[model samples]
Target chain A: MTAALMDGTAVARRSLDDTRTRVSAYRETTGRTPRLATVLVGDDPASHTYVRMKVNRCRQVGIDSLRRDLPAESTTAQVVATVDELVADESVDGILVQHPMPGHIDERAVFDAISRGKDVDGVTANAFLDMANGHEETFASCTPAGIVALLDAYDVPLSGKHVVVIGRSSILGKPAALMLLGRDATVTICHSKTRGLAQFVSEADIVVAAVGRPELIRGEWIKPGAVVIDAGYNEGNVGDVAFGPAAERARLITPVPGGVGPMTIAMLLAQTVSAAEQRES
Target chain B: MTAALMDGTAVARRSLDDTRTRVSAYRETTGRTPRLATVLVGDDPASHTYVRMKVNRCRQVGIDSLRRDLPAESTTAQVVATVDELVADESVDGILVQHPMPGHIDERAVFDAISRGKDVDGVTANAFLDMANGHEETFASCTPAGIVALLDAYDVPLSGKHVVVIGRSSILGKPAALMLLGRDATVTICHSKTRGLAQFVSEADIVVAAVGRPELIRGEWIKPGAVVIDAGYNEGNVGDVAFGPAAERARLITPVPGGVGPMTIAMLLAQTVSAAEQRES
Candidate 1:
């Protein structure tokens, strides 16, 4: 039997609808739209496109957007200062710094500078720790959170599953493993240094590939009935798992372009609304 | 041939001796002994004994000790304030707060209040995140760090090995998994919520049991010829794994009291010296 697809576009549309309703209520009560600050550094074509999409989505959901464009030559201190200003601004309910900010700039230092209250992207170490520790007060990294939401929406029970996460990146693999663990799954995290990757994948009841290596995980490597969630968006929108073969073996699979990518922006919007509500409360 | 036993007592003695020599050098250079503040709340007899043992160990290593005893009636805020004072004190090189401090107290909040620099025990969320993210700048929890040292001392190569960690406690299982991952081991973290725990253990090349459930892991659960590191210390000093059967089958195994217990204090002393050195630098 062919694997059932996890439709990210559909899920995102539903989430955006919910966000629009929440924004309307928030505006009615406060006489102002919820505001989110989007900071984009450097002119990386992909980064620009992603930021533009997010800003446009904000307007669609009735959230006011604040844009900060910084040059590629910006110093770490200057970026941090700008983020600090946004943190202190009363009108800004959420803040997101688009990724791949310049090789010389310390991205973590800048991400940490964003106030936890306004960390809509949940890139800070504190936010990750809170998610790992199962603390109630935490905003998870958007992509991982979105993946979990997709899994739940599809009625895939995580409890007792052997989930082998192939990759350990901060935004995807690491947080996804923690999120699965939170749901009672027996989680194994594999990365560049991991040995016998195929053996681990073959034994897994669920496989999540976020290694960003296109077709690195072969279909034959997957357990026949395991669920597959491919979050990798590499060159040509390819995923870490070899989709055609993996799809044949997986009981459920999420296609690259239609899967985790759309859900990420959906979570960002949902979290922005949540942040706004929390601020008002 | 029987497996060689990992003797924690012997290793701890050597470690303590090394710490003593370092402490002497620090005292001669700085004209002050390294000091660690030990905080205890309520009158849990076991906790009291543990703190006293730690204090005596500090004295043995030429490290000064400061004791703070609070009544069981202390509120979470009160405990946090006490920890905050220690965090701000330049005289305190490290702070060790005895665990299971009253049900009413929010232990996590108190742990977070300890300055990350002075959190030699590595209980703070910041430290855990650092460990998880493979960042070099955070102190590892004492027991987990001690386990890594034990493996290194024994010349066990973790790279490319399947290391199954049985437990999810922030102090032991989680940090141990992170440490093994850092060393290139394919790490799996299991806990009470995990299904088929024995199956996971049976496949591991290295197994670490820190669940604190007395003999919960059966002997047959271990993979034949696997290295077993028992970090559990339950009532009567029993470990999580059934030692008798596991020892018979495993290639190397650590005894209950003589396994990971003594190493905990040894790591604490080593970290305290490191903390003193850092402060000097």
Candidate 2:
């Protein structure tokens, strides 16, 4: 039986619509639009594309956006200084620093420089700590937050369900696992060092593929009728899961391009608006 | 087959000896002893006993100790004010605010008040964030740090091993799971809300029982030859595991009173001394 699509596009649309309303209300009440400041380093075409998409979404929701573009050879101090400027800017409601800055730049130092209050993209260590402690008022990393939103949108019951997340990146897999655990799902985190990965996959009631390896998770490894959320976007629109075969075996599945991607931007816009409201009120 | 004991008491002794050397060396070089300040908010007998033990250990290692005991009726602001004093005190190298402060007190606010550099107990959001990001220079929560020390002392091969952790506490279970994951272990976190707990436990190469319930992990649930670390300290000197029965099946196991308890104190001392040295240098 072919599995039903989770249709993240539809869910993200609804979420963005809600964000638009919130943004309009805030603007009308305060006579000032909420603003998001983005820091993008280097000329990585893909990174630029991602930032542009976020900016466009901000505009669509009536939130103002500003960009800080730095050279590829910029030092860690430079990136951090830029973030500090955003932190001190009274008009900026939220701050987003695009990931994978450069090899020479200390990413953690730059991330930690973002003030916790303005950390809309939730890359700061404080954000991770707050999220781990199950603080609802704090923002979560966009991709993981989006994954949870998709799961909730589909009415999946996470309590006591076994979820195996195949990746351990701090931003993606780790936070995703923690968020699922918060929802009372028994969470397992698997990585490249994990032995017998297929064995672990077979036991999961829900599988989250975020490893960024194209088709790394074989469809046959998925437990029959298990729910699948593919958070990977690799070359040529491929996902970590072999979607065709996975869709045939899964009860519910999220497609790559339209699934996690759109939801991520939607969450970012919604969080930015929330950050503004929180600060204003 | 009878399982070998992990002997945390012996491991802690060796660790404490190293701390003593470092403490003495620092005292000799700087003409000042390292110091740890303990902030005990209430008069809970158990908490007092725990803090007293820590203070005594500090004396044994040649580190100075100070205490701030607040009333049980103290407000969150009072406790936070006390912590804020320790944070600003240049003489205090490390600060520890005992857990389970009166329910009325805001524990997180108290923890956040301790400066990151002086948070030897590692309860601050900064410490958790640093540990989550695999920052070794940052202090980890004492119990989780001790658990890793025990694993290393036994020469347990964690890489690629499946470790099932039976709790999700910020200090004990969650950090322990993340530390093991940093060491390349595939980690599963099961909690009170978990279903089929036995199935998860039976598959583990290493089992960490951090749930406070006595004998919650049964002998029958243990896989043959799996290493078990029970971090639970419950009523009547019993552990989370049924040791008598579990030891009969496990390859290596830590007993209740002599196991995780001492290692925790040892880690606290080591980290306190490290903080002092870092500050002095």
Candidate 3:
């Protein structure tokens, strides 16, 4: 592959290192470590795994992680109450509520109850809109913000460039598109409803594939010199883009497992540290 | 013209009539008139004119208008203080802040201070995002929400349609695009930074011209049978689209003067009435 692989792992490590240093300083100054309340509902295997990774990462960065595991049958009221308690906890600097809650639970309502200042996961509607409005804030949706961080670290040009985001999800696709627009990029959001998605992708200077479907974006559809970021995590550990061929055509490409995954947790921890710092000051 | 003209005026009038009825009902139920606190910073003539239109409209609809006119040199803290008092006031059912506040004032800070329940203008970050997240709550930004209302009134199909929104302002273009995306339209947002704007406009099934540049979108660029919405207000009362040519090509188009302008005030009044109704009930 002639393309330069965008190394998300290395960048994430650097970010983690910086977060670790600041976290140490925060603990020393505040006399208490920053704590992240990780709330996972149900026994979904994937959710369990993600929560474990985030908790472990928090510990690695010298930040404390508080685990709140609820039963699969937890009601919406129970979830909201749990989040409300976390919001009231002065010791908790950040909160992450795992997604895909039980069918009976109302996800939005629970997320809405999280305190905006302590929303390190960027789940609150206020936080989401702030980022969308291009307002300066310490927190943003982890994945989208991480993707932007990757682009920034790699020095990918955003000003006036054409960015085709292949999703319209509130968390991932929508936020990412808005962030790019804030950077003055001409952004086009293509969802499943979009016609001729490939045609749009083929013309974009930067393509962000986030449709969740595994390998939905064929490599041939990528522009010859474009930068490709795959933010999808699907079955069999596959990404939205056909990475092998996409790597060949793209001037820069982010791999599935090592790319956006690590960056998300890193940013979450960093935001947690920031929230702690802001609170202490 | 062969194209069916989207009569924003008639639709807006209908909305206003409905809002008027609701305001009257709210006044009777609450034993007080539905009150809107209009906050205006500085002495800009245009801002004054717009505020006058809104206050007069509120009076016509049987709603009480409380004007809070601050000096041009008002500090951000002063503006925020005024808004907070209005937010806490039992009589104020809705809050409308005129735009283009003095350069020293932080507009976002003042807007955020308005109670979400009473945010009739929908300029608050929370309201902007609620619409973006497709959550059913209160209101949306007046202009964008008005555009959506017009589309719904005209029965313009959005499902799986290509909607190219030519602007990215948080209050206008960005929010409009997100609302369209929520409606299942594949949305693309282009701004001044977008290269070859005409190319994107030409391919769209629906084009929302919100660039604020007069006649920026030529008529020939509009796809045959497409729906065009011009949300631009430029000098001499012109719209962003070249109307004559655009109307000739598109199946539907909104006239500049009678189009988005009236609908904005209509939506604002409608939202104000809605806030009063919800508050009363």
**Going through the candidates in order, what fraction of the true interface contacts does each contain?**
0.88, 0.97, 0.84
What does the lDDT read for residue B54 in candidate 3?
Answer: 90
Pairs with backbone N, CA or C atoms under 3 Å apart (clashes), candidate 2: none
Residue B64, model 2: lDDT of 95
Error of 2 at B270 (Å): 0.9
Question: Which candidate leads in DockQ?
Answer: 2
Which candidate's lDDT is highest? 2
lDDT of 3 at A77: 93
DockQ of 2: 0.84
What's the TM-score of chain A alone for every prediction? 0.97, 0.96, 0.96
Q: What are the Cα lDDT values of the candidates?
A: 0.90, 0.91, 0.89
Query: Ten consecutive residues with minimal summed lDDT in candidate 3 chain B?
Result: B22-31
The TM-scores that each candidate's chain B achieves against the reference are: 0.95, 0.97, 0.97
Which ranking of candidates, highest TM-score first?
1, 2, 3
Ranking by lDDT: 2, 1, 3
